[model samples]
Target: MPTDVTYPILNAQRATELLEIAKSYDNDTAFPAAELKEIGVLLSQVIGDDKFVGSAEDVAPTADLLNAFMLLLICQEPTSPAAAQSALHIASLGALAGNPAITSRGFRLASRYYDALQDSEKAWAYAKKAAQAGDDAQLIKLQNIAEQKRAAEEALAAQQAQAAEAEETAELEPEEPEERERTGTLEEQLNELRDRLEIAKRENVKEHSEEFVDINRQVQLAAFSEEDSLPASPVGVAPNPSTALAKALSILLESAVGALWACPSFATRSHVANKSNEILRKYHLSPEYATLPAGMLARFYADAAGNNTDTTGETAADFYGLAAKEYSRSGNEARELEMLLRKVEVFLIDNDRDEAHDILASRYVNALKYTELPIAARWTVLFSETLRTEAENMFKSTQVLMDFLGRHPIASARSPLDFNALAEVFELLGDRYTSANDAVTAREKYRVAYELFNTANNQEALAALAKKA
Candidate 1:
């Protein structure tokens, strides 16, 4: 029933500020816990204002994300069963919205909650779900925590049972004074030490566990995938009224594609992506849409490619191939090259290095010869980063990076390049030099990286490498 005006305004900038506030909380540091909880309650009102199923689609995803964080803030302790239940509800919303990060957090929070309640089975199940949804690190952490909790609980229960048995046996047949005196004090001390050890172990687990993995920026990236490659609206001729239903369906498909691609568990959500592709294919094959622009079909294939989640990237590669052919047919050479680059990226993600390298060496080289500087620069950066991080060939990585810098100076790229990305490249260059024992050159690279991070006002990255600089 809520109108757009009635919905709470949680835009991207506001969302970023909220995420920073959540990340600032440290168990070791003093923070405004009560104030944050108060904010959470208000946000919860917005998230639960309607059955999330009926909430405004765009606002709901962000609101649910914030609500998950807020719930974590309030439910820091295991005793807050109610808050934990709320987290499960928020997680269900994540499933509905197809957001893996939010879903993973929600399930992990519930796992902690159930673990606190000594429900190991439920905790384990939720933890597994969290892992399946892309928070792979949480699964191991939760398992360790759960094992510790269960052991402590079992020890306490055994201690109580033994005490009761001893009391009953004493009523029937008392122990000798000398025997009791010899064992009583030592037994009590051992029990006390065991209790202290369990408490300390639990504390250690809590200390290592992060409140939430930072994923706000990742969600933003997924939400806007492929936005740059396509035209703002449909190109060529507009659809006639006779094809109105198919056009409406196509619009719906595009929205669904974006939502599904934003999910970190896009692989599990592939069924939805598959169905959307089927619907688009139906429209494309219809005689009523025989006049549909190849550019429009290309856009559909390109967007669909982003949502594809096959493990080997074969299906996604095919979609990109189809999109490239369509773009070529439409005479959009830039878009065709974009699709080819995307195909390379897909292979890179799948770690099909040979395939990715072949494409880069073959089709990409020929395509790059005719592309603009910015497009060519993007491919170079991608290849260099993959070599540095994924392949772990620091020498080759450095060579490629230096060559890129030589050709595309930072000054020339100030308008087009992402400062954080450029700063990271410099940071990696510093790391490469540091590994080679060239301290002087390394320091030079770090200094440039530091300056770039400063210019970008990226305080966290700056702090991380400040000592190196």
Candidate 2:
């Protein structure tokens, strides 16, 4: 009896030793089915938390172990999908516990189980997780599966519908022989006519659609067809050459006046006006020539003499007034006002502050009296105010400046000067709020200052808080 018990113990020990050897081989190349089953039975018996099954680091042959365990679990008589899934899940967790490379393998196993069970939602969930975990292969596989499933469903529905129609047609066939044939023929003709009518209706609807305009435009392109022709220009005699030349010269003079008025750069303005006069002379027309047709002459000039001389403020203002009168005579009120504004701008640029202010104030007040012109006139007033504010920092009231900053936060937030101003205001507000010990208001002011500093990309200030922390 002692010998028999010793033999059984020795055999069990030998079997375990062989199992370990087989596992080593499986780890390197292939896992033998018989050996894995034997090892699984042994593992099921003695495996416990305290058995020193070894750490993940010790399990260098993790892939083999996982595969072997999965095979053993799946080969059970009443193989439970849930059990297989759980085994795969646990194995995957073990594989990915410390190894990022093996993480995708775990996710892939989970996906496979979910897919095998036809649980598409769970499969997609695993697939998305795997994709996020950096598994390109699994992501592509899941996408393909989804596309194929959709295509299959669509095809199946179409086939079923076709089959049902065929069956209906067959059932109605026998009743349509003699009298039915006559009626059926008429019906067939009518149906054919209806189909044609439907097609015509659809074509008409499509023709009237916005898409037709685009299609027509495309077909009309010269590049698309060699036979395409350009549209004819309107036929009219050229304007009297002298008059055309004079009008062009006048337009150029007006542009120069506008330029000088807007920015009071004398040399540039005189140069432009002189060039216009030269072009008029070259084309045989005078500066004061009337009855000039506008279209015959080009609106620009290249070169002219006498531009080097300095232009006085009065000269600029006079020229601008004359240009406005010429445009007004031609019924071009928009151009006339534009020229007037240019003159005002030139005056402002020339440091003729009183004249510039007078012009703007008079025009603005007059415009307000005309209710019909109020909206456009209001825009001009606003533009004038903006220009004035831009000219002199001393003219800007503190409240007005702050309101401007509030309205144009992006512009105000851009420059260091604006940021400094903002910070100063916040600091002052913070002091006022804190003197009364209003913590919330004080904190809000500080927060605004901090945000402004950050917006201005002051990294040093941002890091200062962290250092204190």
Candidate 3:
């Protein structure tokens, strides 16, 4: 069949082959732009003819192929303005063939080219079209640029009006000599009053500064006294007499033994010292009672000294010290050790690792003594073992969980379960499993854990875990 060859119409077969080739080379950097452009030109030419009308019914697929070809050409010749414009034109044609993304991209490319050429009106027009095509970000940027230009113009007009008003005012300003003299007199009087006010302010500040300095010095002295005088008590012991007296001296010292387990303020310290002195005046103070554990009497002295001050000067060490004392005083050794473990946790949070280790060691030794106490004894052993394991592992995996939760706080907030923490644990486990070449088990475990995480309503984590699995 020597048919009429007036136009080159790529029939269905040739079109399919071209489409396959275009798809294959679409994302390949090694693909030639000339080849992709040729394909686009041939497709365009075929599309314009009535011969390929029936085949063009598969327009969506052809459009995708054409879009891919245009994208490849653009990528290869990105710096060439002519190539960019051609790609944009092809994308627009492909859009008619049912490719909305291609249409949106075409608008974006047109806007970018117009912007580079400094054609604001054209750039704005294309940007608006892109926005209409679902490019919200580009639309917002263009709107902001238009708004900025409008604001600049308004500002310039306002400045011109202001200058005109100033010139008019200056022309009229010299007409009233007596009024100007009166205004000058009022201004001078205002300046004189300001000078006096400044002098008074300086004097007031100087007086207040001296008072503040004295108060600060007293606070420091009280802090030092409390620190030096307090004797170290094992976890759960009540403060001894010397510690009580030292605590009594510091207006800033709060009793770790108090209900709130906090320190007293400087004001309270003064009141208590006065009350103690008054008590001494009423009777003969025995020197031996000074060494005795002051008990309720020490607290009363501090209370009187605080004078109902609201400030509680409790530091982290004071809280840990108090917790330790409370634990030591407990009747049940197992419960006491558990409480001491909590104190160790507090010490760790405070970054006092040495103190934490000391508490752990002491509690571990004491827990061994409570082996006779059934449930409590069992708990003691479990807690001790847990603590030892955590220490040995350096809590690295737990730390990873904490960090993950911190970063993806919204995921934690939305989920009933701690998805971020669980995901992190699974991630670490997956890595370990993969390293050991247990792919089958790792895959199953990862899938199950990922499902759990997915159920926790964290899509991003689920996606990440799914990818890993």
Candidate 4:
């Protein structure tokens, strides 16, 4: 029912105003059905297509508010068809855009929508989503429903199979012992099985429904996941999180440290990093304390997070130095390696890749001294990030990086070394070779990566298609 039409994209201030208007909307002060419909369409259009990003700091907030508006609309008119459709559209937008918060809220509304429609399967599906979003009651209800559904389906299948087997046995029974009356004839039994099959298929409409909302057109527009990746605060300084130091770190991590470095203002980043470290230090000084840098980090990809502490004129190297010492005191070698990686990354960021790459080479050998297997593969990725094919006199460093990973750790695919990280290293090397216009070498690097992860979904084909630059 919605049509394509570009209205002037509103700014953050205007988005806020619209949110207030939506919040205040009720039957008495009704925003016309037409206006609400158009807003709904635009909300899906902008975010689904990924065209909503803008230079204004309000961009992310505006997107969030648009989702909030739809939630408010559904809350106001819980029984309306239009409101149900609105909720579905918002859920679809969240799915396509991959916004977990919006997805959670959308599914909550959708559960009620499907329940009102008497579509039990869909109602349960949406209910399950809401439960996953942290609804305890719904989770209990969903589990019970799932058990019931599974048992019903299994029973139905067994009945059908028994009917088929009985039909087969009847054919081989030599006229049922001379004039024996047939009990539930094969034709009648088969018909009964068919009826049950139809019923089963009908109940399965949630997974097989013909009704669908196409979002591919909009998905194509979102060339990157940048908006989801980098969520900005307000126009000025973002507030320091009010929670405890540990909780605050978790909150920041939710937005991601990568996104924090991507913020528009260096000063804001400085403030955040400085505040976080200050809290970390405070905890260390306290009797009961928590650390910000505590995590398994999923395999070999060391946390070489960009030291956004650069704006304060104090380098990330200094931070990593302090971390490395603390980790050393605790005898945490893995963490020490991670902190040392930050040190190497600082050199790369400062455009001195050779220095860090060389230092890492020695560390790689030293690491082998303590390991059961000679697996220095993770550091190869650390070395590869700083390679500049364009630079002169860096041939030795590049050679060292290549030689180290070529041995290829004999670890399982499930090894502690992040296979994905190693694959990334291979891809990056291919990219470097591609940039240098050495297509032959680029293809070789890609092929090596292919051999590392030889699954059906492997990027081997895409890697093979790299053209000379």
By lDDT, who's the top model here? 1
Q: Rate the local accuracy (lDDT) of all candidates.
A: 0.58, 0.44, 0.45, 0.47
lDDT of 4 by residue, 267-321 (tens): 3333434544453443443322333344421111122233242332135566665
Candidate 2 lDDT over 349-462, as tens digits, reads 446656665655456433333322223333243434544455442223233334433544534354664564454455444434544456466567667766666665666544
Scanning candidate 2 in windows of ten residues, the lowest lDDT window is: 298-307
Candidate 2 residue-wise lDDT at 114:
68
As for TM-score, the candidate ahead, 1 or 2, is: 1
Root-mean-square deviation of every model? 35.7, 28.6, 21.2, 32.4
Candidate achieving higher TM-score, 1 or 4: 1
Order the candidate numbers by lDDT, best to worst: 1, 4, 3, 2
Query: How accurate locally is residue 407 in candidate 2, as Cα lDDT from 0 to 100?
Result: 45
Candidate 1 vs. true structure, TM-score: 0.37
TM-scores, one per candidate: 0.37, 0.27, 0.31, 0.30
The weakest ten consecutive residues by lDDT in model 4 span: 211-220
Backbone clash total for model 4 is 1
The residue pairs in collision within model 4 are: 300-418
Better of 3 and 4 by TM-score: 3
In terms of lDDT, model 4 sits at: 0.47
Tally clashing residue pairs in candidate 1. 0
